[model samples]
Target: MGFGDRWRQWMMSCISIPKLSVLINGSPTAQFGMERGLRQGDLLSPFLFNIVTEGLSSLFQKASNLGILRGANCGNGVLISNLQFADDTMLFLEPRVEYLRNARRILRCFELAAGLKLNFLKSRVVKVGMKWSKSNVWADALLCKEGSLPIPYLGLQLGARSNMKTFWNPIRNSIKKRLAPWKSKFLNKGGRLILIKAVLASIPAYYLSVYKIPAGVANDLEKLQSADGKFSVGSFRIQLEDSISDFSVDHKLVWQDCCPPKVEIFNWQVLRGHVMVRQVLHRFGVVQWWEVSSCLTDSIKTWFQGWHGLCPSISHRRVWDTLFAAVIWSIWESRNQLIFNGEDPSLTQAANIVKFRTALWFKHHGRGSKIPISTMLLNLIESCRESPPKKKIQKEEELIPPFSLGLKFNIDSSARCSPGDVGIGGILRNLLGKILGMFSEHIGVYDSNTAEMTAIHRAVTMCAETPGLIGKDIDIVSNSKVTVSWVNANGVGSLKHSKIIYDIRSCLISLGNSRVIFNSRASNSFADCLAKKGSAMEGDFLSREFQ
Candidate 1:
């Protein structure tokens, strides 16, 4: 397959003279060298197999081109001879004795040249838009079995009517087959949901992508997914109703946008008083009353009563719910860790995790309270109390040049999105505001902070490298206050890009009299424009020196 000498050598090393031993009845067979084909499970096996089979596709094409084999005619003057995926080959040809003979000859030629045996017994000659009797005749001629319409191809029925419910039965059966083994195994709601997503959801995706599923079939699949969870909930509700004179709770409160589905399910179980806490286990005679004495002294309502005092503002309901979910989920996880792993539970550690988790969630998903995550972690209640910053009137800000006869680098960075394509640009100007040099370059994929710090680093490096600007006092201006603060503070408390920050600091120190400063975006418009231009460019570093 036109492999280079080095590649060929590497591939041969991987597959040459491999020893194999078979175990029969707990006795190992003698080791034997694999002399015929590539060993099974080798990394290069698939590629080598594809390379061998590729010759067969070419042979079929060659036969069709030479008019030795007649291929099926697609619309718009397109003719298809054969389709090959991995080792499975499907030939499309005009129903003629001559074409079949030519196809057989081509396959034999490929088998001889490639030294790969074709399993004719496992192969099938499927006839389309032709008589059913002719299929057996063709199969006999090819020394293979006959196949009818709607035959399985790549785990999908090729000729089946997709709209019919029968076509979807295979997918449903596959999902059930996968779920059958899982049903016998005891799994939590989280584990079941993961299995449903990872295994069951993927089963129908292949079919759904090729054919639009009928609404009835879709509903049936949904029923299958929720069948176990619904049954459990119904049985528990029935039992609770039998015991209690009045047992009715609105389940809608359990589900919140702030919480994950598993957490919501857990909350639902908790609200229904179905959680197997020590008290519930004691009531069921599973645990003694002595064991339950120190456990769950407060009722469920009292446990969640902290939410009311946490965030009194009605506008911060989402934030409140997020914190509430974080707290409850943390407690649940802590309890599980203590019970399952036998770890000594620390309430303070759990509370800290809950606080940090809530702050993180609010930073990403929650509306209002646009405070820093550190500030939120320090005091969540006060942070939530502070409303989102109101829109202020736009004011013009002027760019201040260097105080002394030194160079000022107005640097700015632009990103398509956070953790996306980033570009850094800087304009070097003297004290009189004359542009000496300017650069616009797409750095790489990074957040805006990294991009901003990179711009400063690049500017400082440029200043240090330039002949005339060497030893000159430099002022690096930027619009990102966070980036500026991090740089000035020597990247203290900056966890994500500490290396980049240190590199920037090193560059600044190398410049001897350089410092990074903060400015409004309005004042750094030229650098911003250049950064945006760099972001749109094809990743080429463009630096222009003005005389």
Candidate 2:
């Protein structure tokens, strides 16, 4: 068939829809007809888009077979025709007239079938390892403009040398634009500080992820920020030693933790008698506050009452603890604003915010807590007493080991020395103690704590990946006191391996049914043996053999 004949045949095959009423403003204004296509803002737009684009994949596959289209062979001998993310598409093709013509034809066919038009004028063709004349000819044949190298895609330069000065200009210019308005004399110091923290400081972070900031650029930015002598409140990398030294005078117990580096710097200030917190308790006079303020004054509230106020019989222990945590969180947040952002610090304001936030956090986390904010603030003690009744929990005997309904994994790790060649091992069992799975890995030259952590991390991962195991109540048993504490607390410390902690916590939180608990080394003998075996091995191994 001829070209006109084929075009007519394709156009005649297109379907048209019946008349539909169109609403302009509030009233029906006209009747119109449109072919059935994917609706704008529909949840299934991406899925439908992929479905429509599947035709391109098939066309390109046939073209590859027919020797009409060629894509760059990226090492493993596999050819890549296109890279797609959401609505953005980058097509890779040999710079040739026939390929360009075929591409245009395929796109036109797709537009006819899916009723989604592609505007060639808006599209740009980028060339790589091709002559300028050849690339210009390809762009002309495709009826698209030639695009420059290093086009911005997904907030990153697609083909730019990341280390070059030109690559950083965009980020530098963006920061300048953001900081310009904040430099006005009309703006207050507090408002400027907020803008600087929120907007100016964050402008370059996206680009910074792609390339390290040069030393000169870093110094220039610091000069622009002019943040000398200001308290850097939000940084996770606080110099704890210097901070503790400053707060340590006359307060002997301020720096007390079994693990010294585990405690955050700001938390030590709000511990008990330090940082004007004594006056805060007196002002609020909430029973929970007063009870824990024994260090502030001897006669105010007893330590025993504070320590054992919420027995196992009380279901509101979580709620009460959340309230205390909310208080500290609010205090810290307020302190940041006051010191760093130039807001005047008020203990009363902090306490008031605590009460408000307590209600919000409790309602969100307490599984439908209906206690009103007014009641919580007015009679905080009574509100705690009036929480829902505690559910009766099955009491496990001290002699009998705790049983989980789904998978139970006893994990252990050992290093030849404290920081030497390490190995991790775990054995999975069901409720009846029949072994279901086992794993062992020699993770080279990590400390004992890291080795222990890796054991639990690998166990949780195995449980997640194994068939019929995900979303099941998986108990991870460990013998190390530090490891159990770290995992049980969801690794909420300032110690090293925060990235791993974040990853493991995210995984566990997603599972929702996973739990970490301590078990005696005697109880975890099999897993311990497997760890010793792993220490002798070269690498990782997993066995699904049930015993």
Candidate 3:
């Protein structure tokens, strides 16, 4: 039976159409039959709405194949179809009468079968990429308004660069609206911090997912902190310290969370206003030596602009991004220390911190990091300089052994920093080294070790579930010695990762014939690449790439 038929049967058998009290302007008009289908506050309303409209998608697909309906083709060779979210639908079709008639007929069929009506007047026919003189004719036929591109779809301002000033207006306006009421109320330092952290910071977080805040928007946001901005230097110091503690070492959210959205580090240097930061550069004699200005921001803008003018490649860009983040964080930390302690913040100390932090961050998070930390600390440019020709990497003997029987699985995980975005990936291979299956997932906010262990556990569980693997000996390979040691020792691990170790042990027990072994990171390159890609993803996701 069709879904509509099934739903109708279920409704008839289960639901009662009792007369609902009709309230009109504070008075009951009269008792009426419950004519409309869904309850006003049904929890399942959205889900049911999706189910009702799901047929429309298939109908459009069939029509597209039959050449009765058509959609715009993307540059990537994918056809654009109607976008749907619950009841809201945007149909993409050629401005042809036949397509319009078929769309109308499909809607009519759906309305009759599902007992749901589409509001034609509220819907708009939007034309994209092409100017259509007959747009009105289609609008009339569809009985909906005619619209154009640059219209709002979902919550995003649809047809513009996400970082454009127009795109940030809503976020700016929202901040203004929130600040208006709070401005009148006298909030103390603690209360102001609370409001900023809880209410103000959360307002733009959604937008942060796609676009980095422009500098003007960021400055505008910082202006909202005017009350706290006027605090004594000591108060400022304490507040800065407290807030910094809450941020991750990488300060990803904190950095990206604020305005002037994160972009190329070179651009960030040019855009940010660095008032007191010149002191650090002057102390280091960087500006004087680099032949840049006394103005810190100007000097940075000059230095980086010249650097990028050299047109660095992808490898060079990665190195610069790490060095920039480390320097920026160190400078900010030093500024806070200068204020709080009433002692001069040593520029040398800040530079050293930058070197240390950048080295650590690059070692783990940097994809294909080639430059050594000693070279990066001493002079990043020197490391990037074209070196004397060297021999290419020679093929090494294979360290990984082919499984003689059953299955062999390799797993790896990546995280940007401790308690940061993490991803797990695993690949299953047969005795012939043919890939059986591969999976990658962006598991949110886990330490690196925990993520590694999770990857191992997932691999074991997946192997157990694989068909024809029952009671068969399976081998699991991992690059993480720590995770392998935990499993080899039967779940005993450092106190910090005890929970993950226990889970790994449990998964191993379930796969009774499984054994964990360590492999060099080079041998496990495929899983490592998958883990890196997964880490870049935003949410918890599991993907099966092959089977």
Candidates in order have lDDT scores of 0.76, 0.66, 0.67
Steric overlap count per candidate: 0, 0, 6
Sort every candidate by TM-score, greatest first: 3, 1, 2
lDDT of 1 by residue, 354-383 (tens): 888878766665543468888888878667
Model 3, range 1-69, lDDT digits (tens) per residue?
255787787765433555667787889877655655666776556666676677777777777888877
TM-score versus the correct structure, for each prediction: 0.33, 0.33, 0.34
Highest TM-score among the candidates is held by which one? 3
Q: What residue runs in model 1 are displaced by over 4 Å at the alpha carbon? A: 1-51, 61-68, 71-92, 112-115, 180-197, 228-547
- Put down candidate 2 lDDT per residue, 97-202, tens digits, no spaces: 8877887887798789777788999877785533478878888888989997779877888877776667777777876676666556523476457656666678
Tell me how candidate 1 scores on lDDT. Answer: 0.76
lDDT of candidate model 3 versus the reference: 0.67
Q: What is the lDDT of residue 354 in candidate 3?
A: 72
